[model samples]
Target: VLVASFAHFCSFDRCNSASSSSVLLNALPRPADPAPGHLQCPTCVTVFGSCPQNSDIVTCPNGTSHCYNGHIAIRGGGISSSMNIQGCVAKPSSFLLNHTQNIGVFTVMENRNQGDERGEDWNNPIIQAGAAPVSAPFLAWVVGLGLSLALWGGAPSLPVLYWSGPCPHWTS
Candidate 1:
């Protein structure tokens, strides 16, 4: 049995601005098995800034192989910023992908070998572990909550899911 719990909190100040915070709870019965040939890749996240001077190396989880580097342009509440990121990806087929939702606007762009022309350097020291890829449904929930908070100007309670046993049977 495995259970994963996620909680998000959105706060609103008297200034009528909203900010969000999230927590992830992993209650897996045991550590997951390692994927064969798991390769470590450089990774970093820079908010409202240029690419990081140095990147950490993280071993991609199962289903991820190639490394990725890119930026996400986000605009909301009369604010705009670029989120620079570098990490491992499962499918590196597309060079770019864009997505927008109600919580303002944002675009995610991918670029491989941005700093280093030779995209095959794996000997770099890793400063920290990369963030795990989030599930689509979870992302949607977060976005929806964020949008609701921003528009309605109130703090809403987020639902918590509890699951036990082999992955529960539920359709996304």
Candidate 2:
């Protein structure tokens, strides 16, 4: 009976520690900006920053720019600037729950059991497909290879073939 009780206490302690750790990790002080500057953004939490390549960015469809602290900036159809983050906790003045009524809720279920009944799980499908994952190095390699092949290796490399009417030399 004592052993069972100790085991139960240990499990409870583990659970509590796990919950506290998650809360701490999620609520850790966000990184601070290197310098102070006028920040323009819709929300504090929506800061932009460097993300791994292939990370998705959902943006405004129209032409206006959305600037946020710690978020990378999209300019002229591409990413132009890195995000400078200044960590600060924001407090709402009042408890306003009605504003979220319009938002929809979705439920996610986690399967904790390690069972063979589950199908194959793919964390990253693109890797399995043999496609490039869009890292900076991979992108550079692709671009360099494409440029070299387009300019040197193929038929386009021969200037004579461009005119192609059987006259060889240039005239004045």
Candidate 3:
């Protein structure tokens, strides 16, 4: 009877151990490069007036193997503005690369993420898309107005003139 009970207990122990080992394996981080020829990196998109406030992970297109982040300034038509952008770019032989367009120039600064040392989970969604762009001219106007008002000695008010004559409703 003792031997039979001991065998039953051992079987139960083995079953529990196998289940726990599987759970631990699932919890462990997967290998960084699960597939070949595909590069994944952080991406951010910002229009000159409407820039993204944060970065997120994105899979790079074929032939592009580097992540880029920086600002682009555009000046013309009496309007000057700038935008911040980040995304995949063709791997360059040098650290920084500049490309000029008809409207403006794009400056790229490489952002490297390897060995997962940066502690960034590229699989998760970092930032939302379609962020509204702030109006530069509107902001400038508000600041200028505020400064003019301040220098003008507070808000304007009308004088409280009082009449010396008796009230029309009063009788002598």
Candidate 4:
């Protein structure tokens, strides 16, 4: 089974709405972190395996325009594993894809291109390594539906798999 890793928000000094001391507040302005908002996306990072169905939704940073989903496979020595990432990005990135490289961590091979590693004859996949076969849109839809069902009395008996407070930016 794939385990989904969730990052929970912890408050820091800046997260506090008002500083206790008026003198301290007057001296230097402390910039506040962006407030959590509705631009939410499923966030998870799974190391060397598939991710879980119940991922935590989080608010994206101010400039983020797209939700990113990526998979990276690593193979070298006796180790053969992959990493999965899903989060918000400022923009959509074009996948480098099927090409391979030796830059380390069994590097290269980025992108979401179709086709295979070698060719039709070799029959190797270029996209969706590891647990990514589930497709991002489908995954998001499933998660959204579950959340709605759990919260809107659609399924009052259905428990929320994971719940957290206001979703801060990527940091949390």
Q: Give the candidates in order of TM-score, highest first.
A: 1, 4, 3, 2
Per-residue accuracy of model 2 over 50-159 as CA lDDT, tens digit each: 32323321211122222211222222211122222111111211111212211112111111112111211211212334543322110000000011112212222110
Query: What is candidate 1's lDDT per residue for 83-114, written digit by digit as tens?
Result: 45555555554242333233323222334445
lDDT of each: 0.39, 0.19, 0.30, 0.35
lDDT of 4 by residue, 1-172 (tens): 0112121133543332322222222333333444443344555656555445455545554655455556655454334545555555444452323244543323434343222222211112122235343222212211110111111222221111221323221221
- What value does the lDDT take at residue 165 in candidate 1? 18
Residue-wise C-alpha lDDT for candidate 3, range 1-172, written one tens digit per residue: 0000001123332232221122322333332332222444444434444334344444444555545445545444333445344444455322222342442221223233332222223333223347432211100000000111111122321111111211111111
TM-score per candidate, in order? Answer: 0.46, 0.15, 0.33, 0.38
Candidate 3, after superposition: displacement of residue 132 in Å? 28
Q: State residue 138's C-alpha deviation in candidate 4, in Å.
A: 24
Question: Model 1 segments beyond 4 Å from truth?
Answer: 1-37, 94-145, 151-172
Q: Give per-residue lDDT, candidate 1, residue 69.
A: 67
Pick the TM-score winner: 1
In lDDT terms, which candidate is top? 1
Error of 1 at 83 (Å): 0.6
